[model samples]
Target chain A: MYKYNDFDEAFVRERVAQFRGQVERRIDGSLTEDEFKPLRLMNGLYLQLHAYMLRVAVPYGTLNSKQMDMLAHLAETYDKGYGHFTTRQNIQYNWPELRDVPDMLSDLADVEMHAIQTSGNTIRNVTADHFAGAAADEVADPRPVAELLRQWSTDHPEFQFLPRKFKLAVTGAAADRAVIKAHDIGIRILERDGVRGYEILVGGGLGRTPMIGKVLHDFLPEADLLPFIEATVSVWNRLGRRDNKYKARIKITVHEHGIEEIRRLVDERFAEIRPTFNGVDQEVLREIEAQFAAPEFRTDGVDDYDIAYADNPLFRSWADTNLSEHRADGYAIVSISIKKHGATPGDATADQMRVMADLARKYGHDELRISHEQNVILPHVHKSDLPALYLALRAADLATANIGLASDIIACPGMDYCALATARSIPVAQEIATRFDELKIEHDIGALKIKISGCINACGHHHVGHIGILGLDRAGVENYQITLGGDHTETAAVGERAGPGFSADDIVPAIERLVLGYMDLRDSADETFIETYRRLGAVPFKDILYPKEAANAA
Target chain B: MARAFTPKVITSNLLLSGDAVWFTANDTWSGDIAEAEFLTDEAHAELRLLEANAQTGVMVGAYLADAKLGDAGPVPTHFREDFRTRGPSNYAHGKQVETNV
Candidate 1:
């Protein structure tokens, strides 16, 4: 993790002081509710149905043991001993009194953390691949750049207020684990010739409207990244839709004005601003890069990782699902699966947090990551440490061996806690996972990312899942709309809606029908759900999910 | 009519660190609210004050009001409507105060 510099420390301290003063003024009759509301929301505070909610940023979803301990302490001391981890790699506490919030922030600041830009129509937390520094296949660690952007965007003078909230994501690996295509600005680290740089993708986002980002720059030189990104956001900040709140994201702006025009504007702006950042931001980036240099590794380990691979069936299954190929020899990057059967997606209790903190200290060389897919990663576990790590994880219920299986769902809080939700998402996710587990057929079904969002904000990234389920309310009854063929990979696509919405009672069965339909149509078991969906389109799945009514036809 | 008015009620939480005092519609935070202080028209305020007394350490903030001030009972619905029409208007220290924008 990137440690805060002097500037960072001063900024957060000043922000906390400002908020404390604001709270005092609101209480003392100087500031009205409307004025204080936006101010409070900007600091990740919300006035929910029953009480006030405070969301704390877990930057890029990465947390160390000290940070996790602080979070656990806050939950135990202030809240109901539970905190909800969001899809955007943040944790939210549902209840915190107004007076206690300032104190809570002070506690968080002790650990180099604050809730700034976690809300409001500003650049929110800059997310990146959870496995950024640790991924064996990474061309470079994306976090240093993500960290640099975080500092630049955090309360930047001009972009303090905008049409709506903006999000940025970066990934260094070939696999798009960060779902870069579904962000306002998605930067993919690439190597051209012998030099490393970025392939900039812009205007991709999911909310009321969903878009697959367009490639803005084929190869953005490493030196020009910050200024170029600043140029793009400056352009979007000015021209993004302000008339309708629903159409305020960059996606709508790109759709309305076309990507070519956006590119032209960004280029023009980049030219103007490029000179100001000459060598300064690059120096800062160089400093950040030093902090993230790869850990030392021993080469005299495994000759062939097949001995243990052949002996254990469970390890074999786990190895297949939980491991990603590393560019390093005698080492593997492990994604410790947290999507246990019937558990809340992305949630880790205080005990679980402590266990993960311990595991990171032991096998992971004091490094831990939170995947955007709602799983944790211990990136640099040696091939020899696999069995021990697996056993420890299994004891904590962290090992379910279903990394991309049907039960490994990514779900938002939905009606359970969110005041903005239309229907329940957590229960639906639980039911689906439970249903699939009971059938004992998740393995048979193969890799399927079933993402569920409470509403159209797409916080759960329902728009870019292999199978997306969106929960909506029709009158008082809950309804679910299904979308298929979407992917959050190197080649991303916005999901196509399957059919008319299904009633809450009918949703699970409809999903089963769609999955079974895929099985029937697939060329072989080797073909994944997403692959088959892309090959055959929505016709087969849609027909199965929304079969013609026999009674009406009769 | 002095006959009776619906009680205005607001939903709020007790702060973790607040003065141990009772808030009154008369904009007073006093420590002298007792069960017997409930008179016919002053019943709602008196009851709320007593309730506030129980949560001594908790910070007292956010109150519902219908813009009506009398000894009449507080109507929760009217206060809820007022809260919706205008956000959490009053802040509490030792007393309720209408904040300025």
Candidate 2:
């Protein structure tokens, strides 16, 4: 929703031109692959397994109808008629040719979007809660501060080359939909004595070494947000190890030097840099806050919605699963499911993108959000308009009402597209979702988060899933290791591994057994899989996952 | 004793299209894995890989991948290399679409 000013537009256009030149040089033999690889990565272009992949930033997962249309156009014109929305709230075009990327970027710049900082060692796209403005429990819209941070970090000279990639997330609600605990810096907007402030956490990350952030500042004043964040990153930038790529992330740095020492260092750095910020950041934040103002709501009865919910089982099931509580009266947040059973998680065809864009324009107050769970959000749909919206989604095959269920999985493009993946993730995710749907008990299972990663990079946030499936190559065979009871919420904790791995063929049945076993183990229907796991611990679940071993022991 | 040397083929992704390509016996890049020059000796594989890496303007990320001689030609020995030749399992968009494999 933050419109690009003249300066922002100029900067983006200039970067596109610069990249265009770099691409030309690379093709013409002036620059070698080694020289051009980093430049291409900085522009969010990667030489993936099958083709060039372009990652376009959807800042804080916010999009207008026009921008959505632009993404559809890019998919139709430059890519293979579909785009994969990633866990970082960015969209990646998987098959763009090397020569067509500059034009693709130029097209993106026209829509106030670019792929800048989507990759590389710079601060990546700063994600926030998908329900930032519409969530009923939010204390404030976190996007204003998120936008301010975007402005501050984009092309910042001091942070151009950190030890490794840095990620930041913000959430205004206590529910923690943004998974803030697993970021390098996680900011929670808080209010005390009717004055707004922040609670800052640092050194959280999910990779080979997963960590939940430690509280660096229990409460930081609203005015000191920028300076304090800069101080924290600056301290890490100086002290973070460069000897090994695996040991370079801030989590390892924090682990090596305890949180207290890191806190002390951050405090010392904050003292040095706190005076440098002269309150201009606050002014910019206020301007951004105005742009995020709530849309005009219609104070009308929802008689049609009520009738549809009562009469049609299909509509009722969809409405029950897909809708979330809105902050405004008579409005509901609609989460459009991109993970239809047997489809690639997070992929939306060009036609589907256009349909979502049209829906946003016609009924969703021109606002759309890409959730980190690989779903799309119509943040401000009126209750009166729900029936029509649902009908449109149903026509597009987007009405798979399995949000927060076992069928609603978050998966990375593992060996399927990624050059670094050790095994395939998408097929595993597909099989699991399809199997669950066939079982017809996803709704019964209730509020399960199944996240799969191709490798240890944790791009799918598998470490935080209620049921995490990690794919790996074991002696050249595809193997999946399961982790149980991970929570991505405020009480975030890494899942515990359930024992030995399963072959690709056995994985789906293994998951089915685990879920079915939970059904028997749960005290009541109200007890979710995660709640039961927490109550009984991983022993029972491990038995369920490794049934052969358990049977042999018995 | 050292493990027996596995036969290998030099592979890279084409610069323009970013599709998987293998060094053929004819000293040119081919998208089809069957057309690759399968090297049985370790010294030959290393030399071929180095030669393939030098074609920077044509491709990127050249490396040696395990292969075994098939009835037609060289075939991938690992699943990753097989996926590279055939494309992703979920879709028919990559080499599958082009080569009709």
Clashes, model 2 = 0
DockQ of 1: 0.07
- For model 1, how does the per-residue alpha-carbon lDDT over A212-279 read when each residue is reduced to its tens digit? 88899999999999999999989988998798888888888888899999999999999999989869
Return the clash pairs for model 2, or none.
Answer: none
lDDT string for model 2 (A325-438, tens) is: 999988999999999999999999999999999999999999999999999999999998999999999999999999999989999999999998988999999999999888
For candidate 1, write residues B10-59 as lDDT tens digits.
Answer: 33433432212224544444332220122234566556646644442333
Q: Which 10 successive residues of model 2 chain A have the least lDDT summed?
A: A541-550
> Candidate 2: global Cα-lDDT?
0.94
Docking class of 1: incorrect
Candidate with top DockQ is 2
Model 1 misplaced stretches (Cα beyond 4 Å): A28-30, A300-311, A549-554, B1-101
